[model samples]
Target: MSRLRRAAGRIWRVASIPLLAIILAFIVAAVVIVVSSVFTSTGLDVFLPLGAYGSLLAGAFGSGTGISNTLVAAAPLILGGLAVGLGFKAGLFNIGVAGQFLVGAFAAAVVGARLAGAPGVIAAPVALIAGALGGAAFGFIPGFLKARTGAHEVVTTIMLNNAAVLLLTWAVNDLVRAPGFSFPRTGDLGHSALPILLGRNVHLGIPIAVLAVFSVRWLLDRTTNGFEIRTVGQNPNAARYAGMRPIFITTLTMTLSGLLAGVAGAIQMLGVIGFYAPGITASVGFDSIAVALLGRSDPIGILFAAILFGAFRAGAPLMQIETSVPVEIIDIIQALVILFLAADLIVRRVFRVRAAKPVISELATVTRTWAGGAPPGGGA
Candidate 1:
């Protein structure tokens, strides 16, 4: 039917943007890798026939352990990407996911380590909830400042990140250090701290990540609250005229975004570290921003993007072991992906593609024709 065809076309068009971005990113990364290898080795032949690319692929996906490690690395990325992507949908910039992540990890560590004699089921949920709440509280500060004082979130969030690093250092060094040790970390969590899945460290966090992706997609696409958030992001004044509260929406979205990021922190602790340390989270929060951008702010795209990042993280060890290449190559590839995705205009211009407006207009005409002159907003 014409209606079906129109719907299919719309889906394809919507899907194409991120697809193009990803393809371009990979191509650019490949070019960079090859060129760099050639320059360092004095010939492309040294790098090309060594099976480096094949080994990289195999190290990431050729065995169960490789796949498990990839999924494990990707777990935090999924939640962090959703956090950044959700904030973008609401037209807010959240650069403090790193701080929020730390707070969440600290909260979970404190709770999981101290809660005595509780069953794993109860203790794990309690710790995770505490972690999420802690992250949400930290996230709420920037949102509140932005809503109340016209403060730029970028500045506040970035400042908060520095403060969080110092505070976490203090906590880990002075208060949470193991009873008899000088190490700047809390005591190891008990069995109850882990989220068991398939007898591996994969943990319950993977399912949580999947659920978070689905929940974010639903919140953005199918809910009234989502509509209000999008409306405000697209046009705040128009949203106000339509009775949507931009400030409330902004605060709520940031809070939820923080909550998700916090969940990432908690899961990282529960699934990987088994305790909190000041440096454990590193820059995953910042990396999430790149992941979200590469995903084009779509949840499904984010899932795949996170996996791609995870694959790089997962394969770094093998890449180092087999090829004597520094693990930093993965970082270089990731950086290139982010750079290309951020400069989307360059890709569009280079491709000489028609602008999005004309494509959208053509789709609209097809949809209108398929509806046989029905009311514009009405479903067929």
Candidate 2:
């Protein structure tokens, strides 16, 4: 019974902050909606928030199409969230997910375009692997620099993001311009496209993303490598003292993170867009950082958070069309969710929630890295 209580308490601690944060964000968003309505020439619409939220829920889940769209949109977000979440677990913030995602997409596009005449069995997996490898290679740059020169991943990754965009833009326009297209875009993926599972938009990537969630959870909870990564994240000095190589762990974690984000980009291109284009990313890489933070770096938590964000993305258009609530309101709500989570003390105080106590939770571990201004156990 005590063990059950402890386990439940642990789960509550892991979940409460994000849940409360989301609820508070929605409540605040309702007020913003009301205030904005009052400012309009039309008198205040007191029921606007309720109607907007209802429409959003309906657009996300009310019909078969809505469900499919939600899952399809969620697929890449899940992968991207996992990428950022994994980096967080290792006490690293992989801000370069955008670059890694784009580079991966480019690599996959090139490979996928070349394999257009081939069978799906041959082309799909190859494109996926190409994307992962491309992402891994790009990821290695920052990891190597961080490990060797003590440079921060955030700075290095941001610079790489610019470099990647420049390179890919040039490649698309000059080198791979689809045999005479004026716009910068790649050729159709053809057979390399992920098989559709439901309607037009739903595809195999949804299940693949779901599978990745368990794979990542297993790696962190049931593997030796996960233990090493967490140790290095908590204390590079301790890991070094224990004869573990912190440098190597850091590099590996970042590489895997890049791989996931690369897969995200690849799947988005192959599954949804059917080609690589500049505007296809739709801010997924940036949104993933919020997803990871809200999930507290747990793979399972990241999945749920990704889906929630996905629902917002999938439903926002309908919500705007139906209720005239600006789609930016969704962004505001998401930002508020992040803000509340970042200020957990406010949430705890407002909700009358107590700390889980004595036991060191994953949330505490991640926060220690933030508060200390370095990876735990010693400066990175």
* Candidate 2 displacement at residue 177 in angstroms: 1.4
What local lDDT score does residue 323 receive in model 1, on the 0 to 100 scale? 64
Q: Number of the top candidate by lDDT?
A: 2
Model 2 C-alpha lDDT per residue in residues 1-380, reported as the tens digit of each score: 99999899888876888899999999999999999998887669989999999999998998888888889888888999999888877777888999999988888988999999999999999998999898888888888777766677888898998888888888888888797667778998889988888787888889999999999999988999998887777666878888887778878888999999999988887887777766555388899989998877778888999999999988998999999898999999999999998888777888887766422344565665445455432334
lDDT scores in order:
0.75, 0.84
Q: What RMSD value applies to candidate 1?
A: 7.4
Most TM-score-accurate candidate: 2
Report how far residue 14 has shifted in candidate 1, in Å: 3.7
How many residue pairs of model 2 clash at the backbone? 3
- Runs in model 1 deviating more than 4 A are 1-12, 38-50, 354-380
lDDT of 1 at 219: 93
Q: Write the per-residue lDDT of candidate 1 for residues 111-154, one digit (tens) a residue.
A: 88876358888888888898899889988888877666656677
